[model samples]
Every structure is written in C-alpha cells, then in structure tokens.
Target: MKHLADLLLLGDPRLYQSCEPVLESELPLVPDWVADLHNVMEEIRAMYQFGRGIAAPQLGIMKRLIYLNVDRPQVIINPELTAVSDEQDELWDDCMSFPNLLVRVRRHRSLTLRFRDELWRPQTWDVTDWGLSELIQHEYDHLNGVLCTMRAVDAQSFRWRPTPTH
Candidate 1:
C-alpha cells in the first residue's frame, strides 16, 4: 500500500527526528487519532508478526506515544516509571527496530507507573508480572529515545548464534 510504504523503516533516511515530550494533556485522544492508532497497532502488530511491544518512534511518529496489546490497548504519553519492581530480572527482548535481533535488557520485574490513561487522566497502576511490566518498560524506553538493543551492557553481552550444523 502507498500509505504503508510512506512509513519509514529502521535505517531509512527519511525517518523523522523524534520530538521532545508533548505534555500528556496535549495529545489528540479523540477517535480520529485514537482510532488511527488502532490501525497503526494492527500494522505494527502484524509488522513484527512475532513480537511483544512496538513504539511510535519505531513507526516513525515523533510523538511520545506507545501502543501495546497485552491487557488493553495501552496508549501512553510522557510516561514515567514511578516505581520499579521489587524484583529485578535480565530479560532477552527482541525489537522490531532490528528484526530477528535479540538482546538482554535489565528491567524491574514489576512496576508502579505514573502515566496518563487513554483519556489523558493522571493515573497510577501497579504492573505485575512480565506482560504488563515488560510492555510498559519497552514503550517507556522509546519515549526516552532508548531502544532495547542499546540496553545491552556490552558487545559481548549480545551474541547472534547461527544454526548449528553437523
């Protein structure tokens, strides 16, 4: 589709520079933008086809936006982690930013997030377990211009193991 082709992929020269945070209250949450996000979510979901979360930056949107399908379609702006999980873990997460590339990233096993709801209401929720917590962390990283790959502590920490042959 011509529309899909317009969305630049990683390393594409036209991918716009990300903008600074647009305060939570400033987001266009009406059905137009929100509904469009649903379409974007579908494309992003299908784009990865086998991944967890995808951020707006990965989709070439400069806004501080995130869309995930774990519990609900969590749309967050200016998201910040108020509290990290009591437990911590090193997780191997793959990103659509780099297809088929996986890297270990440290994340709180749980979190209490201070973010706006879909309606732009300031709310707090305790994200338990990996699904919601990991989703939140992944999206939050994008807002901060940090991708999953950069989380790897060092070059040695990431290894691409090809198929073993006899």
Candidate 2:
C-alpha cells in the first residue's frame, strides 16, 4: 500500500465527516495502516516539529482509528470517551491537517477513554494530565468529525502561525 502523503486539510469534506467503524474483516489492514500512520506522523514531526496524535480521517481513510505517540506509541481502534471530568481548560490547539493555524479551545482536563489496542484487545486509559487529555480529546474530536477550528472559543481566538521547522 502506498504511504499516505497528503493529510486531509482543513475545509476538506472528509475531515468533517464521521468515520466508519473498522469491521472485523478489516482488522487485518489495521496493522499496516497503523504503521503507515506512524510513518506519516513521524515524517510530519520531523519536518514541522509538532504532532503527537493523528486520526485516520486526517489521512483521508475515514476510519475510527488514531495513532498516539505519547510516552509509548500506541494505536487506538474504535476509541470512545467513556467519561470526562468537570474541570476544563482552554489551550492552543493545532492539527496536521491545518498546520498553519492554531485555535484556542476548551477541553476536559481529565477523561476516561476505552479503545482496542493494536492486538484488538480492549483497553482502558485514564488520563489526568492536562496535555495528554487535550491530545486525546483532539483525536477523539477527529473521530467524531469535529476539528479544533470548530471548537474555537471565538473568532479572535484563532490565529495563523507557521509550524516550527527546525
């Protein structure tokens, strides 16, 4: 399979459309796609020096899959936010799809997520760190066809800034 090159940019219809769940029949492809996503994310990070997580929709795959390079790299399949803490924080958010812009948005400070690992075994992750919570929430929004731009606090909160390329 060809490695994904162009991530779905902002205003792309695919980025705003809900992705379909990966069926059992498609499980075999998950590993390869996850690897592809990993490669693309690493390439993005190398060039732009940013990007911690990526969802399948950003790659134009329209599947409920996300790869996160937090403490340890992991692939999340069919992820669902089981719960969120009452605390919320507003932070600048960026995405691979629109690397030139940053939007300030509010996100839960803590959240509970349930997802299947690369092996298809169910797993639960309880996130309390504000940064990780925001990262996961951002990917979760992608799975639901919501972008940081959509969640922007206000027009004045959106700003265009070039990604850091060091």
Candidate 3:
C-alpha cells in the first residue's frame, strides 16, 4: 500500500528513467495506484495551492498512467500524443516529485491525445486551453522518463519556488 510518503523524490534515479506501458494483465492495479495518486495530489494541492495532475512514475510505479483534476478526476492510461501544435508558450511548471522547484519550460499551445480511461475505454482529447495543454505535456513527460528539470530552458531556467507553507 504505497502512500503519499512513498513518492519517488526528485533525485531518485527512477524518476529519470522511462516507464513501461501498463499491461492489460496489470490493469487491476490501476485503481489502487489511481487512488494513491488522487490522495497524494490532493495533499500537495492543499499544501502548495496548486497541482492539477500527477503521473504513475511519480509514485515509483513505472506505468503509463496519469491522473488529472480538471473538471473532474481523470485517469489517463497508455496515453499517446497524436498531435501537437507548432505554437508554444512559456510557463513556470512545477511537479509533485520535486515540489520546491519550478522550471521554466515551453509547451505546445494545443494538442490531440489518445488514451484509455479508468474503465479501459479508449478516449481522445483535443486540448486547446494553454493550461491543460501544458499540464498534459508535463504528465506526458513523466510517462516518457522526462522531467520539468530536464525540460528547463537552461540552468537558470530552474529556480526554487517553494510553496508559501514551505
């Protein structure tokens, strides 16, 4: 029963490594992991005042799964970015794995993604909102072994932007 306390911290080697797809046989674990993600995300959001999404790898589970709380709790499994606009925008992105830091990064302004829902149903999302677009990209990076730190424009692009409570 992995909990909020078991998050793979910033320096954890696993956080820098790629993740494997969630196998059909492993689908049973999805609910538990999703629960953990939601629980931890809630805590982080309340503590920091922001945090709309999280990835499975953040919890040390190398699976292609991500959770988002846009209008509702959304579970994206085996997500694939089908299309990305050439247009981009810069934002100071933050992550649960490294809560104290913010990385200046550029992300697409719109995207089309294909993924499976919590019930294993195929779904497609055409995101146009810059905020959701960037959020998806951030979580997608985690699925592919990339982090905001790696996406930082430069060394100076990374900075300490700890939450007020911190």
Model 3: lDDT of residue 2? 65
Q: Which stretches of candidate 1 lie over 4 Å from their true place?
A: 1-8, 11-19, 23-25, 29-37, 159-166
Instruction: Indicate the residue-level lDDT of 21 in model 2.
Output: 89
lDDT of 3 by residue, 1-166 (tens): 6666888888889888888998878889899999999888888877777789999999988899999998899999999999999999999999888888899999999999999998888999999999999999999999888988888987789888854954
Judge candidate 1 against the unseen true structure and give its global Cα lDDT, from 0 to 1: 0.63
Candidate 1 C-alpha error for residue 89, in Å: 1.0
Expressed as tens digits, the lDDT of each residue in 25-81 for candidate 2 is: 899999888877888888878877888999988888889999999788989999999
Regions of candidate 2 where Cα sits further than 4 Å from its true position = 1-4, 162-165
Error of model 2, residue 38, in angstroms = 0.9
* Steric collisions counted per model: 0, 0, 0
What range of 10 consecutive residues in model 3 has the weakest lDDT sum?
157-166
Which residue runs of candidate 3 sit more than 4 Å off their true CA positions? Answer: none
lDDT of 1 by residue, 74-101 (tens): 6666567888967877767766555556
Worst 10 residues of 2 by lDDT: 1-10
